[model samples]
Target chain A: MSKNNSRKIKQSVFIILMLTPAIVGFFVFYIYVNFKSVVMAFSFEKGGETFYGLDNFIRFFKEFTLPDTMFKDTILNTLKSFLSTIVIVYPVSLIMCYFIYKKIVGYRFFRCLFYIPAIIMPTVSAVLFKYIISMEGPIDVFLMRFFGRNVPDFLQDGSLAMGTIIFYSVYFSFGGNILYFGGAMNGISQEVIESATLDGCGWVRELISIVIPMIWPTFSTLLLTASVGIFTASGPVLLFTQGGFNTYTISYWIYEQMLENNNLEFASAVGLSCSVIGFPIVMLIKWGLNKIGDKVGA
Target chain B: MKGSKIKRSISQRVVFAVVFVLFCIYAITLIYPYIFAFNAALKESGRVFTRDMVSLAKPARWKNFVDVFGEFVVSDSGYFKMTWNSVWYSFGGTMVKLITVTLSSYVVCKYRFKGRNLIYNTLIFTMVLPIVGSGPAMYKLLSDINFIESPMMIFTFAGGLMDLMLFAYFKSIPWEYAEAAFIDGAGHFKVFYKIMLPQAMPAISVIFIMTVVSCWNDYSAPILYMNEKYPTLASGLYSFHERIRYSHKHPIFFAGALFAILPPLAIFIAFQNSIMDKVFLGGLKG
Candidate 1:
């Protein structure tokens, strides 16, 4: 055989060799485990005899009920929490990137300072926020000194609890997003900015016309990935809210079923349902944005 | 108009400065709690509010770290064993991930093989599935199969498809070098090892550090599987905090958190230059 054919053969074998460890791992752990879970989800535990059917799933959906009280409050709170972060963080991150790209003084210092929270563990961040918002914590302590009024429990107050959690979530993670957006902004050529400047445009005009348009692709990338994740991003809630039966999102509810409640079938069903609902909504929105962005570009 | 340009430049600088300061102040607020945590850890159990503790002039209780290490028995027999366990787990995981991801990415990017998009799409699909979604079922399956407490648990924890990050990095590496290596009569392993892996080292290092930090800081796996007899530092930290919180005698629990966080923080600070280069430059320059 020629050297080229021999090389192809060697490459194929090597590829197989390289792929073995991950393949075995992915199959044995994730795929096999998930398969088992799927099978188990169909079976019910009864006196060590497993009865397999759709009964578990049927029971889950039929029996799952939301009290008017729960449906009324946590639903709104969850929506508010989710929307608030997107509304607040994305725009703020974009603006922050804008300044950094402008090469503002102390840009490096500001960038580093903002990103400090990103490296800290999420649980630690939540606990730190909890302390900060506590009655005796710095904010309240300062407020009490000025207003002579007792500061309420930020975590416990129904009206403010979700907002506060959302605020902390957004604030803590803003630094990382700034890095992402800044990187995207910096990817745009300096020549483009200079030419736009030469066209009798100032910072605001250049920003509005050029930078925003250029970075919209990155915005869509973020949207595609992160928007679907709002349902599943329950780590902070787990750490902070503890259960959020008071402010329970669907993901938290799913967690309770799987871990705390041990309704594996129900949990799987809920998990599946959340993916089903969230994925399409995210895809549609992303698709719509891309179309609009393309048309706007045109 | 020329005068206006001067004023505009001045205002622009002023706006930049103002925004920069406000941003700094905002970040300081985020970090203030950690600073307070540091201060709280420094105070002796009951002497938290003493007159001497009121001022920064009062030296921080550096003994807090000493007390934490004492609790860890970190000086005693086999203290470094657990650290080794964590390192091995992360290393093993990274090796597996690096191998799988590099090959899979090579196939998807370099070759037009069958089932290519299928594999790529499946990998992307896994990104949407939360580990928590499968956690309960996985725990049950592992328990039933007698896999809990086994060293194999490390593999389970690391089996998520991280091909996206790997693939993104691989795509940036021009195909020309690999082709040249192939032309030089190098086998695939030789090419991957000598050429691809070396080129991907910057990203590999970043991702490796990320994995190690994750494994080292992880409390859940050890807490769930290893039982009390085989506690990782995080589990130990949790238990220690429980003891302190319940006893109302803070045994420098803040110091414990500090110790828990310090290794990763130090690693992060040491790599700060590389991190900026890799994170932004990799994305942009690619």
Candidate 2:
């Protein structure tokens, strides 16, 4: 073969060799697993026999429509978790990041302190938090001493369990948003900020008008990613409540099905149903965000 | 603007003071738990429940750390074995992912090949298209293939966030270097492995540390796939906690929790700057 032909062959070989692992991984782990999930969703297991149909999906839908079903409850809990992240966690994190960006007193210390949770194992944090808020734990003791009232079992009380989980979720997310938004804000031109300040832009106005718009791309990306993870919006459920106390989220319910119940088909049905319902909504949200991003020149 | 040069209005100063106080309170909340854990871990196991948890440990039981090695056993794996498992699991998985991402990203970013765009688009598409609840299917597939409890399960992480980050990293590096290496009689493999790969080391190392930290702390995978035989520190700690939940071995469990966090904590402290800066950049750019 000629030299050019040999190089072409070599290049082709190189590309194939490089791409093989990723391709195999994609096919087996992503494509094959998803395909199996779809197939499993449409199938049911009989006594030592496998039957393919819509039995699992039909059962899922039937249960999902029923009032007070675990399916409906878990879905609602997941939605609540997602919205809490968007409405409460995101804004709180943003405001905190703004103050940190402004070089608030002890900003460096606060920045590192906030990031501690992100680095620590979620299991460890959950375990510690569980004890800290337990009936006779620090919070309880403080409440009793100061308020002359007994503290409720935060994680055990059905009314307070989900709220506690949401609180944990919000606390855990602060470090990450601080890092991301802080970095984004760091990238903002100092000259522009100085100009805003010279224009008499106060803290709130600067955060609303100048800082937010400048970091819009990062904010939007985080928002989009959070939306993409809507179905998986869960705290450390296994460590905290084990899906008890009416705090089950969709992801935990799916995990429970697989790990505890050993019901792969039903789990797949639920998962596929989520994807079917969630995909279009996510797409529309992405489209809407993109449109807004364009308008805002993000 | 210099700190001294920028003048804050009265309202801005007031806002700053309020924000500062709020941050201080939040900081205390963040720090208080770890302090409690430290004090609680040093207390006698029985006293942890009986005594004031807010106070310092009386007659500090430093042996709790040593005792955890003996007490905190999950699936017949002790503390040292679990730590070893954590090391191999995190490093092994991270190396596999890094190699896969680096190799594929270098090839796709540099070489003019058919299906290159297809591969790129596929990576991005799969990333953006969230596939929730495939855990059951994944578990089944792995079990069927007998990959469960096997180290070979690391290959499943071959394509993920690192792929896009490294793809972007490699794209920025000029192909002229590769051409020069080829002209100097270096083969394609030599050009990639010797010339281009070294240049991508900084990006790879950042991702490597991040992935290692994540993998080290990842309990779910080991809990599900490693079976009861091989428990990493995180998974072992988890199961250990469950085992002692009713027994009220709070001190021993807290000691184990503290032990499990040290490695990752050390890593974060060491790479605080790189992690804080690069991770966000990777996310934004990807």
Candidate 3:
């Protein structure tokens, strides 16, 4: 071979060697795992007997329909958590990002403060929050002192536990929103904002008309990603409630099935079922968002 | 027009004031938990339940911090061992991930080759397409392959969002530097290591710290795979808390939790600017 051909061969070898590790990892972890999950969803394993078909998926649907099973509650809680992200966390985070972007008083301080949750371990946050809302913790103590009555344990009470978990999830999520939306807002032109100010556009009006539309790509992407994670809308279930007090989301239920009960096939089925159900909904939302983006020229 | 500008400024100030107060209250919520944890960790274990949580720790037993090292044990691994586990796991995982991601990203982004766009498209496709509920499948695969509880688990982090970030970062750097290195008799490997990699170091370092923080705090993987044999601080502390949930060891547990948090907290404080700026940039560019 010529010297140029030799160099070309060398480059090929280099590329192959460089890409090998990541390719291997992607194939094994991402592709193969997903493939196996689909297979496992169809396979049935019980009492040392192994069979293949839709047995596991059938069992999943049956359990899902059963009134006594926690499946219904898990689905409902998951939806609630998903709604909390979209309705509560997303809008609230966008507004907060706007305020910080506008350089509101103490904005720098608040920016640092808000990003704290993104850095800290979820385990640490959950532990701290757990203690804070425990029976005799500060919230409890405050209620007793101020209202002259003791409060129920937030994490233990079935009626309030899911709400508490959702609250924590919402709280922990803002930091990430700030990072993304803050970055997006940074891309907005200062000239436009100044022009809006001269036109007497107030903060709310400016945020609604200018800042949001400018940052709509980021906003819409985050929103769509949250929708994709609808089935997996989870709090720190293991750390906070351990799937107790009717606070189990679909993700946590799947986790519990696999880890605790050793029901891999069942967990796979439930997961695959959720994916099948969630895919179209996500696609619809994506399409809808894209149309809106086109309409607004975002 | 000048009057309107003044009016806008006045309205903005009013809004700013309201936002500032709300932020102060929100800031209190964020800071208060850590403060409470620190105070509670300093209190006597038994007294933690009896006393008002807002009250300062009477006698301020600093011994809980000292005792936590001994008390926060999982299986045979003590707190120090767990800390060591965390250090190695985080560093090892981050290094493996960054090295692979950096290498792959550099090659794919810088060099034009066959299957390059395919690889790039695959990465993007995998990222955008959310495949839900593969945890069980992942666990099974790892167990079957004897990857569970093995040090090799770090390699699994080799390809992820880091790919997109590093890819974007590498793509932006002009190839003229490589051409210069080539003129000076540098080969492909030397060009990357000597010329290109150094230029990419700032972005890599930011990603390194972020990944290290994430890996340090990751309890789920260790909990599922490493189990009791090799418990990192997060997992060991979690298991410790679970073991002693009913016992009067809240202060000691809190102490361990505080200790577990300090490394990442210190890291964030040190690299706050780079992390905030670069990570945001990476997110957008990627």
Best by lDDT: 3
Top-scoring candidate (TM-score) = 2
- Model 3 Cα lDDT, one tens digit per residue, A25-100: 7788888899999998888866888889998888888887887999889889999989989998888888898888
Q: For residues A1-298, what per-residue lDDT tens digits would candidate 1 score against the true structure?
A: 6976976687677656655666677787789877766676667777878788877667655655534445345445556666766788788888887887776666777777676676665435565566667766666767777998756877787666666777777777778788778777877887798777777788988888888888777777676666767666633555556555366766666555544546776666555544556767777777788897896582
The residue pairs in collision within model 1 are none
Of candidates 3 and 1, the better by lDDT = 3
After best superposition, candidate 3 residue A152: deviation in angstroms?
Answer: 2.2
- After superposition, the stretches of candidate 2 with alpha carbons farther than 4 Å from their true spots are B1-5, B47-52, B159-162
Q: Per-prediction fnat values?
A: 0.33, 0.60, 0.60
In Å, residue A159's CA in model 1 sits off its true spot by 3.8
lDDT score, candidate 2, position B69:
90
TM-score of each: 0.86, 0.95, 0.95
Clashing residue pairs in all predictions, respectively, total: 0, 0, 0
1 or 3, greater by DockQ: 3
Residue pairs in clash, model 2: none
**Per-chain TM-score of candidate 2, chain B:** 0.91
